[model samples]
Target: MDLVFVFPVNLQKTKVLLSELSFFVNDEPAVIGLSENSDKLVWTGRLSPQKVLIFKIEYKGRGLDQFVYHLDPSLPVKNLRFISNIRGGSNYDYAPGVIPATAIEPHDQNNVSLTWDYKSLEAGVPVGLILPSEKSFSMLIATMTGRGWACYILFFISIVILTIHGGKKLKFYENYLISACFGFFFILLAYLAAFMNFYLAYGLSLLAVSALLYFYIRHLLASATAGYVVLILIVLFLTIPTLAVILQGYTGLIYTLEILVLLGMLLKLSTQRFFQNVMEELFGIL
Candidate 1:
């Protein structure tokens, strides 16, 4: 599915782009879970943008995934002619006519060459969307259920590992306990937000977590409070968009992986700078 060229390239931007230009559009609701193939672009017209199509024009080493999009097509001014060459074949093999999935009428093939020299289309056009059948949909649903939730599970596990590693490093219980407890608080906040809103979930939760983190770290690290606070806030702002990316469909899983990596680094740092005397200090160094 080379996104470089589609019906949008030459057609007018109609209020109804895909359905107007293509035949056999259905009224029933469609589900768009995710697309993993390369060079693929999904189309969602009119209805809350919820239909999906994974297009593959030619076999490729890799491709791209796209969400359903609503684009208007009835706008004027463009070329309608399309042509293609067959691999290792004669010129006659290119019989141009009405292509599939397109709404345009195919020119009469029976007519002989007479008045105009308008060239025939040399390629096949898709007539309309061809989605995965019911069986495929059933299988896809199962995969989504298991795999999507699995990401959450893996995310939880990473947090646990980091907490354990961080906890083991402290020679005293007080500082170690506070840091570990705060980290746990952030993890709980993350999944807590996930249930309500998919897109905003990670971002809001991460903000809550990061603010708590940088503040605590700043209080403990040195005496420069204001500058550290400003730096901490700036980093939190920068992290918000990254968390948003994590919440995005399909690819957001990568963002979760990044979170895990960061957690690991955080844990590693905690271990290296473990506070053995912090608990004793709270007791006036005993």
Candidate 2:
């Protein structure tokens, strides 16, 4: 029988240390010649029928993104049981074609065990684990930048609706300035986040933008109008988009719900007297 164990020594960022390697047959320590080449340990030995064999190896490694137990593609496996005790991250998944764990039990804070038991498995499908990758601040900023149009469109639409509903007129240049301010939110956040914590930078950017919008809208229209605009800015620009970033997996769901909620709000507001007057003004009939 030939056996091989592959370690993450060469692939990982940190050094991997192998402390113990042993093989036994028939409850006695058998001296087996083990060959080491790069990250793989290989051994070939003869086995008699009904003779039990056991091999154990221990290693310590760090910063490895994945762990996979490779099985010989030409052979069938029977009665295989694998368990992995994980620390730190909780989110994990299997590689393509790898069978998922049969049980996952949480022992304590930051400790969990994954178990897979199979009576038989065909060749080519191995046990694999995928660790969660940490999100980079730069990546977050990039996502925010790419999705910045959502924030601007929602804010712009709210401004248009509120101004029209309140019977206020906004000059072309005034609309341009408001759009610029909304765009500046992303630019300001990208720069600030590079110097400080992301959350702190985000809060500062939000406050600065909100304050600017509040004063500018109040100057152009009224305090009540400005208040409403500021509230809309917070919800659309800061709250919804940031939440979508934090919950990256559920971004589509969050945005879908946001669109539905906004649609409901617009339908309800359209029935009001002020909005009807604006419709009449624009089309000369309502």
Candidate 3:
């Protein structure tokens, strides 16, 4: 890959500082052939106002994944362009920035040309292109499933506590099995997502698990009211929280507010003597 920076001459001795001009070739640092002073590529030159100075940097790299160019905010850039030739099944995609004046993929040759023309340019966001990867979707699913485990554990604890407080005479093994089923919902969604849309798989898995758990809870507690309560808790604490995690960026705030609201409701309910009386009657202590 090669990068060229063009500077407009202003009839004054100008020194351009170049640091962090390192590139990796085949997962190793590329050999840079430049005179450096204290790890800085110092380019000094003097030219007339009407002249332009061009600096070209060349490097050879293998297995390059992405190329990012961060414009120095202090420098004024009039125009910037990126040109590349694609090969070996490598494709490119860019983020939001100055739209490329030329089409990236040309049908005649496996090459891409992009230009950003500006009357005057100020440094803003970094512009970059991501190289193609095979495991992008798989990695995404893995991350989502890993985070979902936390939600599963939270739901399991809630269920166990609710069952115990409701005075259900269930064995330890049965409770463990119920919790396992709740955790399995996420695993099911993960595999299903590989074959279909993620949201669709998530909805289907949630409905299946919720229905199964509702009936199981009703049978275990011998009360329709207990089953409905469990269902509501699963929806509020498990389903919605999992969705928030998947959405990203809103997970922390959503979870904090959810826990606060739940705690507030618990405190309000605890103040009622009826709740204490029921607990005492069921457990016959405290």
Q: Judged by TM-score, which candidate is best?
A: 2
lDDT of 2 by residue, 1-286 (tens): 5544333334543543333445444456655443455554454566667765555433333345777777678988887777777765677778887778888898875667888788887864577688645457668878887887867786786677667665686789989998888778789988897666678998898788888887888777766756776667667666788779868899999988988887897799789987777766756522
Pick by lDDT: 2 or 3, better one: 2
lDDT of each: 0.35, 0.70, 0.61
Q: Count of backbone clashes for each model?
A: 20, 0, 0
Model 2 TM-score?
Answer: 0.50
Pairs that collide in candidate 3 are: none
Q: Which tens-of-lDDT digit does each residue in 1-286 have in candidate 1?
A: 2222232232233321232122122443333322354233344445335454333222111111111212223333223322221121121211233233222222343211111112333432332221211122223323433343334344333333333333332235535544454345335544554344333554565556556655554454434453254344334323432334343464466555656766776566556534323333334422
* C-alpha RMSD of each candidate structure in angstroms: 17.7, 12.3, 15.3
Tens-digit lDDT track of model 3 for 121-140 = 66543555664443343455
Write the candidate numbers in order of decreasing lDDT: 2, 3, 1
Best of the candidates, lDDT: 2
Instruction: Look at candidate 2 and give me any clashing residue pairs.
Output: none
Cα lDDT for residue 126, model 1? 30
